[model samples]
Target: MKVDLFTLVLIVFALGVCVTLVDVGTLFSTAEATVTDETEITSARE
Candidate 1:
């Protein structure tokens, strides 16, 4: 099997986009969890 330069570039770009999207998603979920946890803690303290 053989891949040309253009094909390789496309594959790399696709992988980069996927990784970036995953990172953003993970950051959002983590932030949401932290906020929820803080709210629960505050409510409990009240």
Candidate 2:
């Protein structure tokens, strides 16, 4: 079986998009956790 250049590019592009989305999701989750921790620390100090 032979693959065409356009098909190959499309597959690569899709994979990259999927990876980026996953990374963004991870960043959001981490940011949320960090914010929550900071809030708790601040409130506790008061």
> Which candidate comes out best when scored by TM-score?
2
lDDT of each: 1.00, 1.00
Candidate 2 local lDDT, residue 46: 100
Candidate 2 deviant stretches above 4 angstroms: none
The sequence of per-residue lDDT tens digits that candidate 2 reaches over residues 1-46 is 9999999999999999999999999999999999999999999999
**Residue lDDT tens for model 1, 1-46:** 8999999999999999999999999999999999999999999999
Q: In model 1, what is the error at residue 37, expressed in angstroms?
A: 0.2
RMSD of candidates 1 onward, in order: 1.2, 0.4
TM-score of 2: 0.96
Model 2 residue 33 lDDT score: 100
Error of 2 at 28 (Å): 0.5
Candidate 1 Cα errors over 4 Å, as ranges:
none
lDDT of 2 at 27: 100
